[model samples]
Target: MRTRFRARPRKWGPLRGLLAAAAVGVLVFPAGASAVSAAPLAEQDLGSRLAADYEAAFLTQYNKIKDPANGYFRQFGDLLVPYHSVETLIVEAPDHGHETTSEAFSYYLWLEATYGQITGNWEPFNKAWRSMETYIIPAQKDQPTNSGYNPAKPATYAAEHGDPSGYPSRLDSGVSVGQDPIANELSSTYGTNNIYGMHWLLDVDNVYGYGFCGDGSKNAPAYINTFQRGEQESVWETVTHPSCETFKFGGKNGFLDLFTGDSSYSKQWRYTNAPDADARAVQVAYWAKTWADKQGKGSQISSAVANAAKMGDYLRYSMYDKYFKKIGNCTSPSCPAGSGKNSAHYLLGWYYSWGGADASAQYPWAFRIGSSAPHQGYQNPLAAWALANDPQLKPKSATGATDWATSLNRQLEFLQWLQSAEGGIAGGASNSWGGSYGTPPANSPKFYGMAYDYQPVWHDPPSNRWFGFQTWGMERVAQYYYVTKDSRAKSILDKWVPWAINNTTVGTGGSFAIPADLQWSGQPNNWTGNPSTNTNLHVSVLNKNNDVGIAASLAKTLLYYAAGSGNTQARTTGEKLLDALLGNTDSKGIAVPETRADYNRFDDTYSQGGLYVPNGWTGKMANGDTINSSSTFLSIRSFYKQDPDWSKVQSYLNGGAVPTFTYHRFWSQAEIATAFAVHAELF
Candidate 1:
C-alpha cells in the first residue's frame, strides 16, 4: 500500500501573540491605473494591490487559527499550514486537508524571505520565521532520542524497531512541525534514515545565510545548529551500522549508504550511496560551512566542512567512475572501455541502487544505464549548481577528472547530442532492451515512447515528443552560463530558445494557443527512413492547446537568457508570452478554464471557477491538466518588469478575496505571496 500523509481539517485555534504582528496599513495605489507613468498598471501597481490583499488575507486567516504555543498558522489540522492551502476552491472550506512536504515548505521559506526583502513589511516574514523556528524545526527533530539499535535484540529487530536516536533523519511532511517518526518518514522502505531531512535543514540554513541572519535575527543560530546536529546524526547512523561499516571497495574504510533498503520495493539499487544524493549532501555541507566561516563563527558549524569533504570524496572516487560511463560515439579517452553505439552517456540508474557495483540487470529495462532519461536533465543541473557553487567539489586535476561542473557540461552536451536536426531533443533514448518494456521488436535505438510525467513511455511516440517541464533545464544551463560565461551553454540556449519560440502558438488577442514545447519529432533510423516516412506514428497539434506552466517556464527562461545574452528577440518573445498568460485571467484575478489533471488522469469538474491560477488550458488534448498556480506565479515573477500587463495582473490578484484553485493550495498561496513580495522588491 502506498502510505500517504493525509491532513485532516481542524477548527481554527486561538491566537495569542500572533494578532499583535498583523501587517499594518494597506498601501493602496490608484485603482486601474499605473502608478509609474512609463510602466503598465499591471507591472507598477499590481504589486501593491497584491501586497495589500495578501497582507489582509494572511492576517484574517492567521488570527483565526494561530497556534498560541508556537505562533504557527495552523489549518487543515496540520501545523505550519501555508495560507494558500486554505484558499483553494477544490477542497472547499473547513476541509482543506492538503499534504505539505519539506520541499514545499522550503519553497515557502524562500518566498517568505523574498517577500520580506521585497516589501518593507516584515510581519509575514516574522510570523513564518517564528513558526519555522518554534514549530517546523522542532517537528523535524522529533524522533527516538535513544540509539535505536540494541545488541541484545536480534539483528532483524533493528529493522522492525527502527532507529531510536532522536537525530534529524526524519523528513517530516504534512501539517505541524512534528508528527509520528515512522509515519512521516520519507523513503521508509529504504530505512527511515535519508538525506532529504538534512536537505531541508540546508534549505533553512540557506534562507538565513542569504541575508536574514545579517538583519539581527535572533533564531538563525539555533536553526543552523539544528541542521548541523542532523547532519552529525546522519553520519553517526552510517558509521555505527554494521552493514555499512563492513561494506568496502578498493581497500576503502568507509561506505556512504544512500537509501536504507534492498531491491524489494524497486529500490534494490538505492541502498548504496547515490551520486545525486551525495552531491546534494556535499553542497549542503559546503554551504553551511561557508555561512559559518563568513560570520566569524566557525565553532558553531565545526563538522560541516569535514562532513562535506567526506561526502565529496565518496562522490568523486566511489560513485562517479563506478556508475557513470561515457557513450554515444565518443572519441575521448574518458569514455568507458566498451564505448560505442550501444553505450550512451547516462547516470547508471537514478542512483547506485546497491553499493560497490553496477547492478543494472535487476531493475526494469527503461531505468537502466544508456537510457538518457529526460528527468536527469533536471537533476543533473541541480547537482551541477551545487558543485559549481562550492570549490571543494571541483575537479582536483586538470585532466581525466570530472567534477560537478564537468559533469554538468557533459550532461548538457548529451542533451544537445540527442537533439534532432529539427531542434527537438529526444525526451528519452533506449537501447535493445526497449522491447522488454513493451516496445516493438525489442531493437536498439527505438524511439517509440511518449515523453510525459517525466517518464519515457513506449506508446505512439510523437515525432516532436518532449516534456514541457524539462525546459526548465535550459534555465539552469542559462544560470550556469551567467556564472561561468561558458560559450557552450550559450550556444545550446541560442539554438533551442529560437526553435521553442517559433513552435509556440499565439492567438490573435495575445493569448497563447499552444503552450511552449517542441512541435517536431526526429526520424526513426531503423523503423522508418525518415520522420516524414512515418505519418502513422507522427503526432502534431492544431495550435489550439496551451500548457500554461510550460509556457510560463519557457518565458522565464527566455527572460533569464535574454538578460545574459542581450538577445532582443528572445526578450521580446518572452514578454509577449507572459502577456498572453496574463490575458487568461478573469477580472477577479482567477485563471479561467482551470482543470484538475495529471499525466495519466484528467478531470475538468472544477474547471469553471477557482481562486488561483490554473495549470494550463485544456486545449485540443482536453486533458483537464493544470499545474500548481504558484509555479506560474514564480515564472511570472521572474520577468514581471518586462511584462506589459503587469498592472492588470496586480489589480486582478489584489481585488481582495484570496484566489482559489483545485489542488496544492498551500503552494499556490505561498507563490502568490511570493510574486507580490518580489514585485514589491522587499527582498
Candidate 2:
C-alpha cells in the first residue's frame, strides 16, 4: 500500500521566475505591509504581537490558494502549475499521483478554530467551518441510495456519488473542467476522518464556549449531531472490517485495528487497526460525549462513553502485553481460535512471533497488529494521553484515579528503563520486519523489495546509541510531569535534558554526528564503515547540522520540564536551541538547507527555496551530494517567532512575496496557520 516515488534533481528555472515575480509587484502583501514592523516587541508582548503577524500571514496565503467556490485550498501554488496537469493538481509533477488526505484538512480546521479563539477573529473560523461542512463532511456522508448500500457496511463507495469531491482531484481552473476525480479515500470510509475532525471541533468548543461553530446559533448543535452520526457510523464500519472479525484477539468480538486505506507512505494499509489510530479514536469519542454533555444534549452521545471504554479496554487488555506470548496464552480464557503459527493470514500469530524470544525481559510498548515491537516514540505516549484523560477507561475501584496514575508511572518507568547510561533514550526495539540496506532472509515476507520476519529480537544495548529524531517520548514524559507533578518523570527529564544538550553539536561540520539509525548489534554495516568506532549501530549518518524537527521537539520538551521543575537553565538552553534553529535562514529569511527532504516526496530538488526547516546541515544524499533537508515548514510553524529572526520569517510568509517558492497543499498551510495561532502565554 506504500507509494514509492524517486526524488530527482530540480533546476532553478521555477525558483528564478518566482524571485523575479517577487521583485516586481506581482505578489504584494494582501494585508498591509506594515502588519509586521522591523522592530521586535518586548518579551511580555511577544505572544500577542506574533499572533497579529501570524494572522496577517495566514490570510495572505489562504486568500491566494483558497478555492473560490469551495473554501478548501488547492495542493500546489502557482509555481509548479504549468509542470503538472489540472487533474493531478496536488501531485508534485511526474512523481506520486494526485491525492489529498483528511489529516491535512483536519489540521487546517483545528488551526483556524484555535487561532480564532486566541484572537477572537471569527472570519477564519467561519471560512474553515464552511469548507468542512461544504466539502469534507458531505463527502463522507455520500453513498448510494440502493438497498445494497448499507451505511454500516465496511466497504468503500465511489467519490462520484459524493457531493463536493471526496479528495483533491483537480484545480478549480477552467482547463480541468468535466473530469471525474479519482480518490481512494479511507479515512472517510473508516470514520477516522470525522472522528479526528470532531476531536478538534470539540477542543475549540470546550475552550471557547458552545455556539463558536460559526457563531452562536442552533446550526452549531445541528452540525455537531450530523457529525456525531457520521462518526458513529464510521466507527461501526471499522469494527466490522473483515480483518477485525477474522482476527479477533483477547475475547473482544468487535476489537478493531486498521489504517485508512490511503496510499502515501510505504507502510500505508499494510496493517489494520494501528494502536495510535484506535487511541486517537477513543479520545475523539470521549470528547464528543463531553461536548454533548456540556450542551445539555446528553442523548446525542449516550453511546460515546461506552464506545470509548470498549476501545480503551482493547488497548489495555488485548493490545498491551508485557511480554510476547502465543495468542492462546496472551490472556486468561485465551482466544479460542488462536494459532501458534506465523503468516500474514494469521494476524495474531505474526504479532506474537514477532515479539521475539526475549519477550519476558522487555517492558510493554503499545501493541500494533502485524508487529510485536513497540512503537515507543509514536504509539506509547498517545495511549498514555488517552488513558490519563478518560475516567471511564479507568478501573472501577475506590482508587480509580490512583490506578490511572500508576499506569502513567509505569509507562514513564519503561521509558526510563530504555534510557542509556549516557542519558539518551533508545528508540523502541527495532521490529524484525526488514527493509534493511542488506539482504533479506529466506522466510522474509516480501513487500516493497524488503523482508518481514519475526526472529532475532533486537534491542539497543546499554550505550550511547539513540534513535534518530525520537524526541516525542521525551516530550510525552515531560508533559506527564507537567500535568501530574510526577517526580520520576521530572528526574528522567533532569538527567536526559543536560545529556542531550551536551551530545547535540551545532553547526555544519566535518562528520555528520547524528546517526539516522543507531544499532547495538551492528549487523547492518551499510551506514558508515566506522560503526565500530561508536559502539552503536549506524544505520545512516547525516552531516552535522541543525535538525529543525528534533531541535524543536527537544526545545519544547525542555520548556515543559523547565515549567514543571523551575529550572531556569533548562529554559535558557531550550530558548537558545530554538534561536539556533530560527537562525538557520537564507538572505530572504526562509529556513534553509532542508534536512528531512523525504517528507515532501514531490520536489526532488532537496535543498531548494522553501520555508523548510532542514533536517540537519551537511545532510549527505545518496548521490554523494551534501544538501539541506526538505521543508517541514508547517510542523516548525508552531515554534515560530520565538526569536526576532522568526518575525522576518513570518513577514515573508505573510505577504513579503517569494514567487519561486511553492506553497504545499494542505499540511504546510495548516501547520503554518496553526503555528501562527499558538498562544505565546503557554510557553
Candidate 3:
C-alpha cells in the first residue's frame, strides 16, 4: 500500500524520557535488552571509507527510530509494538497513527535485520520476531474453535458488492464451494488447526476500546478491522469494529448487520491477512540469514528463520480462490466446485481470511482465500524461492515447499505478462469479475483465463493510481535478479528501471521529485509463451512529489539493479537520490512536509466519500457515538476532534487553506535505514 497521508504539522504527545539512557553507544539496543553499549563510532574503524560513512548514516536513522523518546513504539510489559506512525492524529490505511499493521511489523523486522548486519548482534532481530509472534499473530486462546473447521465445507458463499451502499450482501448457501486443499495437510504437519499467520490490523493502544478478544478489558494491541464493504470503501468511508465481535458495541449483532445480511449473527472472532506483508517478513528473514552466515553468526538467527518458514507454510492460503471455486472462465454461480488443487491460482491475492464461533458454540469454523490478484506489488519471488530452495527455510508441511516452487515461476511469468510496452507493469487480473464470478466485458485481456483490471481491489482513488507500487514491486524483482542473475527478471527491469529514472529527479539541498500519481491507458496482451507487448498499453506520470519513503524504496531498487547489471547510470542515479535523502533528516527521522488536501474529506457523507450506514439501521460505537443513516465520517469518530491536530483540519473544513505536516512513519524511517545498510553491504 502507498504510505501517503494528509494533515498539518503538530507536535507529538509526551515523550518516553528514555533516550539518554540508551544513547551511550553507536548501536541502539531494543527495550528489554542488556543495558550494555557497543564501541563508539570513532573507535570502530571499518577499513573502507564508503562502509564507514553508510554505516554511520544507518546508525543515525536507526537510533532515532528505536528511541522510545520518539514514540515509534510502545512497550507493553515486555513486548514492543511498532505504531503506524509516531503521530496519533494521522489517517491513511490506518485510521490512527497508533494503530499498527502487519506492514509495520514487517518493516520492524527489516530494521533489526539491517542492524544485525551492521553490528553482528542477531538478538534484536530474533527479539523483533518474538514480539510479532506474541502480539500480532492470534494465539490459540484467541482462536479457540479452529478444531471445528471442516475442509469439505470451507465457507458459505457471499457475493461482494461494489460499494458500502450495496453491503450487508446476502449470504447464498445455494452456490457450491470447493474443498480446501491444504487445511488437512497443514493441520497434520503442525499438529494443530490454528493459523500461524499474523492478522493484518491491530488497535495497538486499544484506542477503540476493543479489548482482548472483545472482552472489553482495556487491553492494548486488540484485534480490530475496517474496510469490509467493497472496493469503493476507502479509509474515510469505513466503520471500525472488533475482529472478535460480541455485541459489546454497535447494533444488536455488533457491526455484523452493516456488512452481511444473515438470518442470525453469531458472536465470533475473525481475521484478514495481507499476503504482501507476510511475504515481506520472509524476505527479510532470508537476508538476515545471508548476512549472519557471512559473519559466522547464522546459528544466532536459526530460530527466527525456522519460524519464518512456518509462516510461509500458512501463507499459501493466499493462492486459492475465495470459495475455492475452480479458477478461470467461471462466469456463473453454477461453475464447478474445485476438488483439490484446481482452485489454486498460484499467485498472491489481496487477502485470505478465517473466522469461527465463540468457544461455547458448536458451529464449524470457516476459511476463505481471495480471487483478485491485483498489482504486481504483492508478489515476492525471492521469498518464494527461499521457501522452495533454502534448506533452513523450506516449510515443514509435505507439499509446502513444492507449492511455493510452483508459485515462484508463476509469479515471474505474471511479471512478464503484465509488463507494459512503456516498461511499467499494468494492473492485475481477477478471476471473479465484480468479485462474484460475473461476466467480464467482451475481449477483455486475460492471464491464465483471469480478466485484467487496471484498478483491481479498491477503487475509491483507484488501487493502481500510486507510483509507489511500481517501486515496491520492482525492488523485489531487482533483489531476485541480483541474487540469481536471472535473465528473465533482468529483462523486465531493463525496461522498467530506465522509465523510472527518466521520471525521477534528484537535486541539491534534498530537493527531489519522483512519480507520485500515475495514469494508465490500454491493457496488456493476453498471456502466451512469448507474450507480445501491447503497444497500445501505456502509463503516464500524472504527478510527482518527494515522498521520502518512496524515494528511499526507489533507491533500494535502483542500487540492487545497478549492482547486478553493472549499469553506470543506474548506480549514479541511485547514489545521488540516497545522498539527497540525508539532507531531509530531522530529530525524529528523515521526512518532508506534506499538504493533506484530502483531510477535507474527513466529514464527507456517503456521496462524498464518508461513512454510509444503511437507513433505519442504528448502532453505537463503544464510546456511545450514534451510528445512523445520516452519519458522516466524523459523526461516528468523534475521537478525531480530540486529536491535537484536529484544529488544523477543523480550520480547513471551515474553508481555510489545506494544512501541511511532516510525518515520521515507522516503515519509512526503517526503509531509510535499510537503504543505507544495503548500500554499505553491497558496495
Candidate 4:
C-alpha cells in the first residue's frame, strides 16, 4: 500500500529515524508557512548526489520506452557492439506497444540537460547526436535546414492506408533508441513494442528545450562544433540549414518536409505523414518572426514570427469561438474551469497576456497551484520562468529584475509541502518519484491517473495539499530547496539528506528497487508486472534504478549548502552519491547517460534492471507484439547537478557533449517573480 513518510504508513512500525540521518538536527518541526528547523544544518555541503540514483535510472531505463525491432535499431541491426550496445543492456523486453522516436529523443534531452548542469559543459550530451546518426540520419538529408546528429524522423507510414490527412499518427511507426528487455521478461515478442504512439515527441525541443545542454541543445548543435550542413558532410565543418528554395508548402496536397540526414551521403525523404496545418503554420510563423527580427538584408522575422503570430491568431480565433470566454470564477457543469484541452486554454491565456493584462491570466499562466490529481500544489516552473525572463515582457513589471519573490515563495511552499518534518517526504520526493504515487481512499477512481496502483490499495484518497500526496516527494524535494534558498528550504534540505546518506554505499545509489517501485507508493491494486510483459516496458528496463531523482539532485544541493562549511562528513556523503550515479549510467566511462553504448541492461535485466541494464534478456520481435518500456531512464541529468563531488562530471565535460538543465533556474526565477515580479514587471 502507498505509505506517507509524514504519516509513515502507520503499520510500518513508525519509520522513526528512517530519515533521521537526513535531518540536520533532532527537533520535531511544525506545519506550514512560518517555520524553524530545530536541527537545521544550515552550514553543510552536499552536492549533485541528491538525485544521482534517480538520474541514472531515468537515462538508461527510459530508452526502453521504445519497442525494439529485431532487437536492434534498423541501422544498428547487425552492428551491435558488445560493451557499447549489447553489453550493458538486457535484450528481452515485453512488446505491447510501439515506441516513438520523438519521446525517446525528448527523454534523452531531459538527461543531457541535468548532466550538463553538473559540469557546465555540453560535450557529454552527444548520445542524442549518436542516436540520430544511427536512427533518423537527419544530417544525411539534402534539405539543409534539418541537419545534424538529431532524430528527425519518427518513422514514415502510408498516408492513404486507413489514415487521414492528419489523424493517422497512430499508424506511424517510429524506430529509434535501442531494444527493450521487458518483453522478453513477459515472454512476449519484440513486436509487441509498438513504434507509433510516439508522435508528440517531435519539435519538443522547440517547445521546451533547444540544445543538448541548457544553452540550446535542441535545434542548436552547440555540443558538436563541426556541422555538415554548414560545410556539406565534412565532420570538421559546421552544418547549415536550407536558406530558401522549398517545394513543400501550401497547396492541398500530401507533401512532406525535407531534412538533412546525419549519414555521410546527401539524402532526402518525403515525410508523408499527415501535415499538421496548424502546427506547420506555427512553425512557419516562428521562423518568419525570427527572420523579421534579424537586421541587415536577411530579416525574415516578419515571415517567421509574424506568420506564427498570425497562425496563432487564427487558432486563437477558433478557440475563442468555441470552448473559451472567461467568466467570473464560476464552477458549473458546463463551464468547467480546467476542463477541455487544458494546454489550449493555457495558450489562450498567454496570448491575452493573462486576461487582457489582468490577474486571472497571470496567476494561472505563471503560478496557479495544481489542486487536482496528477499535478497537485506544485507550480509550473515554465510559467514562473517565463514571467521572470520573458524578453517580450515579464509576468510582473514592477518587480522586474529586482526579483520575482512570489515565485520563490510558491517554490518554498511546494518544497516544504513535499517534505516530512521527520525527514524525506510523504513517499520521498525524488524527481523519478513524483507525488502521483500515493494512496487514494478505498476504491477510488484513480491513483495518480493510472487505472490500478502497484501495491495493495490504499484506504484514503490523497489530499495532496500544497505539494499534494506524492510517491516520490523526497527525491525532487531536496533539489527544490537547494536551488532556491527559501527561508523554510532548510527543513527539506535536512529531510532528504539523511535518506541519501543512508541509502548510498558509493556504487549502490541508483534506480534500483523492485518491480513494485513502478507505482512508487504501490499500484492501486498489487502489481505483478515484469520488465517485458507489462504494457509499457520502460519500468522493467530501468528496473534496477539508482533512485537518482532525489539523491543526485540533492547531492549538489548538499554540496552547495555545505561548500564553505568545510564539512568532511557531508562531503563524503556527496561524493558517494555522485559515484553511485556514474556507476549507474556512465556506460562510456563518462559521468553522463548520454553514453548509450556503455549502458546496456544486464542479464537478469531480462528480469528487470536499472538504467535498462541487468534486467538482461534479448529476444526477437514476433507478430502482434504490443508492450513497450514504461518509465523513462533519462532523468540522470539531475544527478550531475545534485552532487557534492563533481569529479566525474567534470571529467566527462572536459571531453564530450552534455545538455545543460534550465529547469531549476527557470523555475526558481518564476517562483521568485510570482511572489514579487508581478507588482513590478506588469506595467
Q: Which candidate is the best by TM-score?
A: 3
Worst lDDT 10-window in candidate 3: 8-17
The residue-by-residue lDDT of candidate 4 on 1-683, one tens digit each, is 00011111100001111122223222221122122211211322333222322222222222221114212122233321111121111111100011122223322333332333322323323343344333322221211222121111211211111111111122222312112111122112212211111111122112222232222333421111111111011111111111111212111110111112121211122111111222222322222222223423123122222322322222221111011212112122132222222312121110110000111122211101111111222222222323344342232122321232334344344333333332333321111111222233454322212222122111121222111123223323333333344335455545445544543444343322211111223212222221111222111111222233334444443454444234455556554444344333321211222222212211111123322211122211111111122211212122223333334334434564332211111111111112111111111
Candidate 4 ranges with C-alpha deviation above 4 Å: 1-408, 427-483, 503-557, 560-570, 581-683
Model 2 lowest lDDT segment of ten: 224-233
**Per-model TM values vs. the true structure:** 0.45, 0.43, 0.94, 0.32
Residue 419 displacement in candidate 4 (angstroms): 3.2
Model 2 CA deviation exceeding 4 Å by range? 1-72, 75-117, 120-371, 380-386, 390-410, 429-469, 505-543, 584-590, 595-679
lDDT tens digits, residue span 147-224, model 1: 232111101100111121222122211111111112112123324322222112211212212112112233221111
Question: How does model 3 score by TM-score?
Answer: 0.94
Candidate 2 local lDDT, residue 573: 57
Task: Tell how far residue 6 is off in model 1, in angstroms.
Answer: 19
Compared with the true structure, all predictions reach lDDT values of 0.32, 0.32, 0.83, 0.24
**Count of clashes, each model:** 36, 20, 0, 249
Model 2 over residues 72-123: C-alpha lDDT tens digits? 3332222111111112212121211122222333445444444444334434
Estimate the Cα RMSD of every predicted model relative to the unseen true structure. 17.9, 18.5, 4.5, 21.3
Clashes of 3: 0
Better of 1 and 4 by lDDT: 1
